[model samples]
Target chain A: MEIIKIVSLGIVATVIIVLLKEIRPEFPMFISLLTGFAIFTMILGELSYVIETLSTLARRVNIEFAYFSTILKIIGMAYIVEFGAQISRDAGQESIAMKIELGGKVLIMVLAIPILLALMELILKILS
Target chain B: MGVVSFINSWLRDIVVLFILISIAELIMPKGNLKKYIRLVIGLLIIFTIINPFAKLFRFDFSLDKVVFNYAKPETFNSWELEEIYHNQERQIEKIYLKKIVEDLQSLIENETEYELVDGDISILKDEDNYGQIDYLVLYIREKTRNNSQGRISIEKIEPIEINRNLEKDFTEYNNDESIKALISDKYGIEKNRINIKIYKKGIGEINE
Candidate 1:
């Protein structure tokens, strides 16, 4: 209904998740997964619309489609890794979560190279 | 959305997850079901605290859209008369709609504002005509940049041939006799308790 409602639900879900973790640790992880999915389902319609509009705006600015998609990809990865990392910590494996995060950072850096190369080429031409 | 996600990039990780879950279930320290349930809940919160970990197993690649959606709606459910809230999910457009309508309604209903404030949402009819199967309309007025304003106006636009300029298909959330059912179904707020106020410029609000 409102943004606050979602927050409350999140809090409740978090509380439930915390209680779940101490006993059946596996169930806690499952609940975490389900909660992640539930939140996504809740806001899917809105995010889709925003992404669609942003894509349109990028097109209007004549930005390369590949460039735009790559940006979305990196963003998508960060979100997933972060979500999973937190769940790991909730499961009391903070070390595992940190490792997962490090891996995500590396991948993002690797994926960003093409964009950097494109920008460098543009700069060289401008200098010429 | 797919028949199979076989051989996808996350396949290895997903299989691992399935295996781990099964193992966790079998060897979960022989605790009470309640404790396990609590653990599940804890896992969820911990999961939220560190979101990026889930990314590794993600093949589709959009965790923000999923995780935030789950988290946001839970917060929104806490408001007074929340039952009256429609489309309770995290619609980004609703944020814009609510803000715009809040101003428009205040201006039109109060009438202190001299300038016209208008906001409208409509669901058109027919697949061939437009995708709007239903409609929502919102309007308001303003006298100046200052906060002083009039009562707001809002309507649900329909495929009516006659009322283009007229604010069509609108009912006050409170006091509208006709909207009793819709209000009951969409927002759980009672139809009678809500003190709905309405006003219009050239024409009055659609009561009948």
Candidate 2:
């Protein structure tokens, strides 16, 4: 079963990380990162299916494409930043993790600006 | 979101974050840097969790105009703001009232030396004011023995006290007369103004 495989991967990774941590402290981090990547890749299919379903549902509901795309971009930024920040932290580079998080925030804010401006303009239009 | 997708994405993030946090916990030589590092890590996790909800906050002016057309623009904003405020207020009131009920249940149980099985508190808010608690009604059930054959259940309704301090012992038992006397003595309200409902434990019948 997929569940059994994932569980085994986790257990195996944990054992390897623990053993490596005592003998070669530096190597455990790499093992941890690899395990995370492997698990993430294994579930890529399910994630894409969910995204596709949501997209079609949004289309059927007549949501504007701009808003939908901006939201998708924001979600993308969040995931990417989380992944990068976590990896950097695992490598014991706290400052680098913080920088990645800052970059993510700036990108999300940039992506949100258009929607924010559109809202402001609508408010101004209503007032006039 | 698919169950597998959620597990796949969040599981890895959780495990990685858990490992990093534990490492941070161990190797942190200084107390001050540790606090800042924790804060930064918390913020990163918060941003990740908020990713899906970012779409809900996206404002499309064209679509939102439908709501604006139904009401004056100024009133529409204020009305929406008020609705949000009221929702938050109600949630806080519910939580606070529940806490008070629990405290009161324990306090009454201790003072009366009786086991309280369950209790509920209902509060009336002032109509003219927002979030002001006006009056409280408490419904409490005693933990009675399970001697079903001989026990007669009586349902009693009683008014306790408005200004009676929770810190003081008012009524020791679930009796109507003592509670009314206590409320009248403590809050200076007339005995007629006070009402108490007394319920018999086993039968669960109303005592008129």
* Winner by TM-score: 2
Q: How much does each candidate deviate at the interface, measured as C-alpha RMSD after superposition?
A: 19.6, 14.2
lDDT of 2 by residue, A41-64 (tens): 887886677667656654543344
User: Each candidate's fnat, in order?
Assistant: 0.00, 0.01
TM-score of 2: 0.39
Tell me each candidate's TM-score. Answer: 0.35, 0.39
Q: Can you tell me which runs of candidate 1 are displaced by over 4 Å? A: A2-5, A18-27, B1-208
Please give fnat for model 2: 0.01
Tens digits of per-residue lDDT for model 1, B1-208: 2324433424443444344335334423231122422333233233322222333334332333333333324322466326535355335445645554454344444543222234444334455854321344333222322222554545533232222454443333333454334433543435453332233332332221
Model 1 chain B: worst 10 consecutive residues (lDDT sum): B139-148
CA shift of B31, model 2, Å: 22
Cα-based lDDT for every prediction: 0.47, 0.54
